[model samples]
Target: MKGSRRAVVLGLVLTLAGCRKGKEEAPAPLPPTPAEAPAPGAPPSQQQALPPDMRRALSSIAPLVESVKAAVVNVEVRDAAPSHQDTPWNGEGPDSPFGEESPFGAPFDGPREDAPRQGLGSGFVVDARGLVLTNNHVVEGATRIRVQFPDGKEMDAKVLGRDPLTDVAVLKLQGDVKGLPVVRLGDSDAMRVGDWVVAIGNPFGLASSVSLGIVSAKARDIQAGPFDDFLQTDAAINPGNSGGPLFNLHGEVVGINTAIAGQGSGIGFAVPSSLVKELLPQLEKQGSVTRGWLGVAVQELTPDLGSALGVPTGKGAVVTEVNEGTPAAEAGLKPDDVIVSAGGHPIASGHALTRTIALEAPGSTLPLTLYREGKKQEVVVTLGTRPDLEGVASREPSPEQEESPQQRVGLSLSDMDSRLARAQGLPRAGALVTEVVPGSNAERAGLVPGMVVVEAAGETVRRASDLARVVRDAPPGDALLLRVAVPGGGRVLRALTVPKQ
Candidate 1:
């Protein structure tokens, strides 16, 4: 029994030894490398990495703002009248609303004391030698004009030229102004409606004020000028903000601040800079703007009018009247035909058609698209130089004609005839209303050229003389009510009050 027990103990001890050997045969862990170890006293914190593509885009447009800020300038104009100058419309005067009695009880007769009128506006240097760009309204009739730089340097500026029609003017500096920062011009034609833009101007005498906004709209016609293709924005432009630069994100001038919606909360407008580039050469050469003329009166195509004229929906201006011996007549473009496109650009409106045609150099052949009686056609017209009415014909009436009572309604009126109505594109024949003089009685009567008079003074006037006799027969009164039939079929009742004689 002792021998068997010793054998069992030996077996158990062998099993234990096998277990210990297995434990001792286990592999050891490898030592840590220096590269994998954390820094002496610091531990890793949570870190996020940006994408590679984002880093590249941020670097591209970072310099644009800085480059644009250097070029914009603030202009201040001061007009010092004579010390004895008459005070015009003083609100606190006896004739003013704030004064005693009716305030307006007395009429202003003579000039009173005068004070110097100071005006503030913005302008930008367009040339390195210090030629500045500003609105003509800024420095017009001002005795003294000064340009304030972004660096706060004030220099006296001289008006180089002023174009009131376009509201654009150039100012040249007399003093030393070398190395002036000039804004880079951008192609405004490439801008879209929603593109981001910046405006730098003086609003309410605040100099070098910068505002950012997107292009709210394009080709806005405020009717401020013939070439009024404005860029509308919500950039907080005010009265003194005129003649400022509207810049794109690329640090280039895309538009010029010209006008604003009256007392609006945010609506502002800028003239396109592309026009400045186009007119700058002509302004520099002749101190005036000269554009090509087709001598054709065109009308915009309305949906109903387009259908009646058999023109496509997207067609161009409709030639309502072609002047005799004009380039339009010479080009075989007749009345009622639509000008679809010009010079490879689609002509959508009468304004656009006129603008594109004006862009072409005088005597240059312009490729034009036309729609005639539902048929598509094309014509090449050689544009002609515009004629100057002031140089060719004087507007002053002869002294002998002064015996006639001057019409105070801002219009010169005559009775309409069927032939004249047809020439004016009237759908029906009626007594014609001719020329409206500026600030004349007929003008105040809301009478426009080419209007047919169906009734006047509660009587039907069949002839121009009959209408004139009615006006001559009526005693001076405050109002004249006339029921007129429109040529297009609708009957309109117009009430025109006579101006106090």
Candidate 2:
């Protein structure tokens, strides 16, 4: 029964992988140079050429490519996947920067009981001494990392440090290095939508391929991770393109290509260089990043909620439930408190608040502007270290987690209380599954018990009755959409084939 559900986890951020979008401009082609001039005596009409405008457009990106291609490198990693390793795996390598006790595991790939695998990605040299920047997802769990340059010179590299929260990793060449070719990082905040950009990376193991497009969007929040102010581009960034540098016309690296939207064609995301600027020193020194947390649950205020709450602006992050003894509770923050600003800056949404708080240093007191009970007030709260996604305030598992597994086709869902929800970092509303029957449809569909069912049949399933109703309403032999929290962490959508009654 456990094998029936297919769980797909898009990493660090959700990515869509496919062809290019129709609206995006294709890479500009280079015009024929004077060196390729038609044979000396060729007739004028026989000498074919593109129009002036086309030639000019095609030539704009070639100079930028020539300037930055030297810094781009292809990264390859070979590692064993959850099988036949001497040390009992806790989901990390021997030198994990997070240390042994970290709750984070070996990324959100499928079950580990498989064989060895090869990971392909990209990166760029950032300094003359051979410091390289790339996505953490590219090098994580790598047993050996090999860096290949434009001239096909491959060198051994060691992981210096990685900030998984931001999906950024830094590496260094094995020996002393100086005066090596490098790429300059630009201000990602200065880039606007429709701005021309180019990407140089190894896609599908093809080395040093170049693609160009405009910045399709910015500050995209895909919910792949917390620090998610991604710059979306139409550049052709495929699987092997992760960790590559997305360059601007000035030949500066503006973003680090990280993910391809798993649903869209030609849509890719990059980590802003501004954020990379902040993370460099910390990752270089501390080996991991520690972010500040507000200890409050909040969500964006919808129009209906705004009307009901009497909010004048009808915009801000609305407080959900303040946990006991947390900074929010201690600061007298209550449910329905609309956070309008932090340290004088306006808060746009819950995600904005999340990013703002995370940027602040822990243990520092920060001021918040809030609207409560139809009155504006100021509150000061001390920030705490950001909690692990799977480690919620170190709360113990709820007794509900210990309930005996039941059987419903293949799944046995149970009750979930606020305490368990907080402990598990789960949505407040969901039906918890305790078991999955072997050989059942749910099993075949990869639905494991202990995985929380947040939505089913395209609707919220907060209770057992909701699950039953959704199951009953489904047409026989068709598939039911279920968004479930897979065991160990990370959420995935599974298509559970409904067995005919």
Best by lDDT: 2
Q: Show model 1 residue runs off by greater than 4 Å.
A: 1-65, 79-116, 388-501
1-501 per-residue lDDT for model 1 (tens digits) = 000000000000001112234347633434444644556666456323323232122323324555666667766654333221121111243322233311111221112223233456777887887888877656554455667777787788877776665667788886788778888667788878867677776666666666767778899865554566878887766656678888776677888776654434566777688988988777666666666889899988888889888876854798899999988989898888898888889888999987787777888888788888989898888889877633311321232432112232333345555565565555343456656544345666777666767777688767666666566555544566776665555567776655332
What are the lDDT scores of the predictions, listed in order? 0.62, 0.69
Model 2 stretches with alpha carbons more than 4 Å out: 1-58, 83-114, 391-501
Poorest 10 consecutive residues by lDDT, candidate 2: 1-10
lDDT of 2 by residue, 1-501 (tens): 001110011111111222247787766656566765576788998976634433344444555677778778888664333331221212234543224321111232222343223456788999887899987766655555678888877777877877766778899876556657898888999989977788888776677888878889999875556667989888776667778888876778889887665446777788899999888887788776778888888999887887788787767999998888777777889999999899888998988898899888888899999888778899999887777764422322232332121222445667667777777776667778766655556778888756788898789888766776677566646788889875456799888886432
TM-scores, all candidates, are: 0.58, 0.61
Q: Count the backbone clashes (under 3 Å) in each candidate.
A: 17, 20
